[model samples]
Target: MAGFDLVVRGGTVITASDRGRYDIGVQDGRIAALGLDLEPGTREIDAESLWVLPGGIDSHVHLDQPQPPGIVQADDFLTGTRAAAAGGNTTVMPFVAQIKGESLRQAVTAYHAKAAGKCYVDVSFHLIISDPTATVLGQELPALVHDGYTSFKVFMTYDDLVLNDRELLEVMEVARREQALMMVHAEGYDSIKFLTERLERSGKTAPYFHAESRPDIVEREATHRAISHGELLDTPLMIVHVSSRAAMEQIRWAQARGLKVYAETCPQYIALTAKDLEGLNMEGARYVCSPPPRDEDSQKAIWEGIEQGVFSTFSSDHAPYFYEGSEGKQNPKARTSFRWVPNGIPGVQTRLPILFSEGVSKGRISPETFVALTSTNHARMYGLYPRKGTIAIGADADLALWDPLREETITQSKMLHGSDYTPYEGMRVKGWPVTTIVRGQVVFADGELKGEPGFGQHLARELSPYAKPGRPS
Candidate 1:
């Protein structure tokens, strides 16, 4: 009988801090050992000249959430996770939104029902606290954190979801007490409203105007305010999907002051520019995600942030909505103005390719930094560390085998997600994940999904990885 279940041999294994050739032995879904010459196993994968990396952990994604009647997300857990697997991500963390006047626990229960038997990779939840009542803060919040939903998101914008400063402080206090992390969607809602009204009055309702309404200053101000709140309560905060140079500067300032203000940026900010929103006719609506893409200068800033460690993680922010028909980007409300169009872009599957091609291949970042941004740091910040993020003894055997020289142009037909269009269509990428392993099983191999929809399980998270040293657990 073979001593181990499987062995991946002759590959250059890479992590945030180290890289080398090793034979990885796996048993019962956990990494058993790494060595120069390992014992034989029942199964063997030849990884000669390939790069074996920890599977990307996309800590920010959206799937199966309730949307307005006409607007529906094209991808749910099944398709979304399938896409993630194909793109080299072995784990995905999405949000569980708490609707107002509902029990926070009940909201989680309902989301669990949605995810049941549909995920193709490991998954977790970050609660979207839209209704932070006393009972929720005093009882439900702490209980959920104990149950492993240790992080929550808050918004300072959106009519139905935005929380005032006082409410934000109350919620932050709870996070402090419970030792949970807070991720903020930092955009000034009122400033957006004011700019949007002025633009509409001036007849500047084209998709391009969406950029004008939510300028860099808006994000910069909200980021500053969010950091101030974190400073006041002595709580750690993470700013998500930072899109502009101004916002990056705000995050840098906070970090300089010794505050635990972490940052996350997306591929759109690094690759696409606001000019994409100028697509002819209403085509520009396809790129209409909030805190929209900025100019070349902003793109330069995003790359600089990655190189400087100003960003702790890089995520897809994969929010999928169809591009056509009444229920999607063309909803009657959207036809009249850009304001009604849902704000998101689908990039769950393309995130890694774009980063690897633009960052690693172009010499903007190193392979070690790539692994850290895409996997290790996200796992660490979101509390999945040492288990799902690294290629060490006793960690979950989630990994991606890569062909760094593989070249291909992106197209929707070749993709696994439900989105009708890809923003990166026709863009050539230099690197690709040829195989994705989850636990000890091959979920995606050579561009095909080998795992079933229910193969993944739910992950319960711990306290923030960025929490100060010596802080109470």
Candidate 2:
């Protein structure tokens, strides 16, 4: 009989806080040992000269869920998880959107149905509270939080989802009482509305104008305002998809004051520019994400934030939309106005490689920081730490073996996403994952998928790991 279920030998093991050459032993789907040499097992993968890091934990993604009329996401749970596994992610967290008329419980139930028996990687849910009614704020939300849905997002911009300051405070009160983390999409709706109306009046409605409509000031103001709300309630707040330097300064200011304000920035902010949204004609529509990409200066600031430890985590914010068909990015409703265009791009599979190439390989960020931003910090902040984000004895055997010198151009045809386009199409990146292991199972190897749907289990999270005595102080 084999001494262990599997053994990964002779790789440079890297983690957020440690690094060394070690061998790993897996048994019963958990890491059973880590040492200089391990007993042989039934299965052995010789990882000589490879970088063995924890499989990525993408804390932000958007799988099958409700969307506005005339818009449909290109990927559902199964396809999304396949894309995740291809990119070396062993776990993903998407949102469960609570529509205005539905109870939070109903939304969770529907989301569960959509994800059941369909994921190739582990998944979790983050509540999108569009209707925090009295009953929900009073009972359903608290109960749900206690039952393991410990994080939820609130919007401050979209008309259908935006909450007024009073409503924001009410929701914050619920989060505080329930010990849940509140994530904010911080961009002032009125500011965008005002600029949008002005742009329309001037007939400046192209995709490029989309950037003008929501400049850095809008994000800066809202980020500052969100921090104030968090401070007022004495609750920890996370600002998501932070894209501008001005907004980053707001987060830094709050952190300097010893407030529990955390921030996340995405690949688009670092790798893309406003020019991508200025492509001639409708081509620019592909890059129309909210809090749009900024200038090189902002990109520099984003990198600085990462290096300086101002940002706690990084995510793809993988909101995928196909580029063709009536339901895709070029939908008829969006042809005439930038306001009508769906705001997102396909990215989940390319996030790690792009960051590894542009950030780590180029010496912009250290390997340890890469692991911290892409894996460990997300796991810790979202309450999946030891189990999902680390490679140690007793941790889930989720690992990614990397060929650091591998290079390739990112093209849509090579990607596994259901979407027909990638914002990174034609871009070259280095350091591809040669094999991805999830729970001691090889889900992806040498560019081939070897896993099936329903192999993923849902994670029921605990309270924010950052929460502590006088947490906001």
Candidate 3:
């Protein structure tokens, strides 16, 4: 047989369902062989004593997204994908949000332009349907889905983004017919508005009040309602960034009844709390994401959800905004009212490490389960399985070689992202990814970036099998 293009030797391979020591041979960016004593390749690495796993797929990142005047996200495609590669991810799916009056295609086109020649890891897009007009639901959406954009997210909160019940159902109906997955950001808009007005009427306008205004009940009620919509339409739904126990119970309730309800939780839900949003001098603004990190009890519930299989994927939900800049978390209006703070934190680079250290290293979860949450499940959920999310032959050589015993303290200076700060600073983590390979090439190795911008390719995805309208067990 002709010699392999590259080979990774003597590493313990862990996939979502399998684990063993093997030498992986790569040719033309695909796994060509997996066994002991593989033939020599043009290039080889001694991966002894390391845990070799599929590179992470952060399915919920925001890079160079359009924002209102005077507000901007920190990372564009180049820096964001570089950070993703450095952090052991081979694929990232950021959103392509439809502007209020613009066609979805226009948004997709503009987004593609922004990403062209500016990525270091593979990229895909998830559409955000903020304006599901009659024409959109009738023609544009179905066409987009058929063109390989098979999953789209809708919101139930945020003044400019929220879709009313009727509009949401229209979109869900299209999803049902098109066999596309529907992702929802479930939070009651009116309830938050009422609470915010009430709080501001009094003296409770601190950054901490951002948590109080949109309490768990807001998410719970909206989650239940969104699930009900899916149940009515017999469509599968994915609830994104679930934080509160109340919302989780709603998802659990739907799943018990054999509804096709999938859930996703983020790093914030497991690592931070609402109290983190109570910093002095508006410093709390850094942690001011929507469904803002709940209390310790809620944190426990999030972990429980992960252990019990209530969550199908763990994503970064990386919304990058600098804390000290006028366009970021500390924007002029945000200085006075928590309501004005951008609702997200930077985590695309830190997502895998945090989960590995807290869940796998601490024994809260097996490494196999960790792979399932951070890698395999994301691929399956987003229709990239077999191709992007496994260690088997014929899969892409998207790999992260880990030093399972390595320990490092988290700091913004060490991050490759464009953000000015990281919410995970000072966190000590075990088991870092020392090498990240994409498409048979080492993109990041030994703490140095090896991939150049534009090396990554855009992927056109198929419909997720999980999007089908039946319970999965």
Give the per-residue lDDT of model 1 (tens digit) for 24-82: 99999999999988988898899997999999999999998888777899888989999
Query: Cα lDDT of all candidates, in order?
Result: 0.92, 0.90, 0.93
Off by over 4 Å in 3: 470-473
Q: What are the per-residue Cα lDDT tens digits for candidate 2 across 109-202?
A: 9999999999989998999998889999988999888888889999999888999999999998888777788999999999999999999999
Extract clashing residue pairs from model 3. none
lDDT of 3 by residue, 137-173 (tens): 9989999999999999999999889999999999998
Candidate 3, residue 300: how far the Cα is off, in Å: 0.8
TM per prediction: 0.98, 0.98, 0.98
Show the colliding residue pairs in model 1: none
Better candidate number, 1 or 2, judged by lDDT = 1
Question: What local lDDT does model 2 show for residue 404?
Answer: 90
Output the better candidate (2/3) by lDDT: 3
